[model samples]
Target: MRHPHPLPPPGHAEVRIVAATPEAARLIAEALRRRFAATEQRSYPAGGEGGTRLHLTVDTTHTAAAPRPWPATGEASGARRLQADEI
Candidate 1:
């Protein structure tokens, strides 16, 4: 049997969006534009012998880059638990 494609890491993802109306599809594509390198929407004829149908395909994919070095030369800085009185 065929297996589904596995997802990437937490910072990486792929999305395939399909909508009947242009407006609805555009809204989805716009919202996710920043998270992906490219968002492409296209029209295609429906499978039938009669009239054509309107459909939108919004396909986008994102891949995370390699980890970068810390900016500072000192030890790492992180948050610490505060005392009850501090709260």
Candidate 2:
């Protein structure tokens, strides 16, 4: 079963994109909006600087499906395990 909140424990994944212009950033943001369904984008001026920064947030809980292999274990399981050798 999947919880109402389907998220990894808590960490960050960094991504790099080639968005050299405002139009390119808008296009990239639009593409992400379609893919994630629930997404929000905002732009704000930084301090006294003349440049604007874009912020994006995505919520995937509603679309995430239930997990398979209820109790993951053993060799055939999809979960990762720490072997004695590694320990």
The numbered model that scores best in lDDT is: 2
- Whole-model Cα lDDT per candidate? 0.48, 0.51
Cα RMSD (Å) per model? 13.8, 14.6
- Assess candidate 2 and give its TM-score to the true structure: 0.38
TM-score of each: 0.34, 0.38
Predicted structure 1: lDDT: 0.48
| Per-residue lDDT of candidate 2, residues 1-87 (tens digit) | 877844432332222234445565667666555545434567665445454455665545443334345354456534678878886
Clash totals for all models, in order? 0, 0
lDDT of 1 by residue, 1-87 (tens): 555966554544455555555555556665555445443555444345332333222233342233456545455434455557886
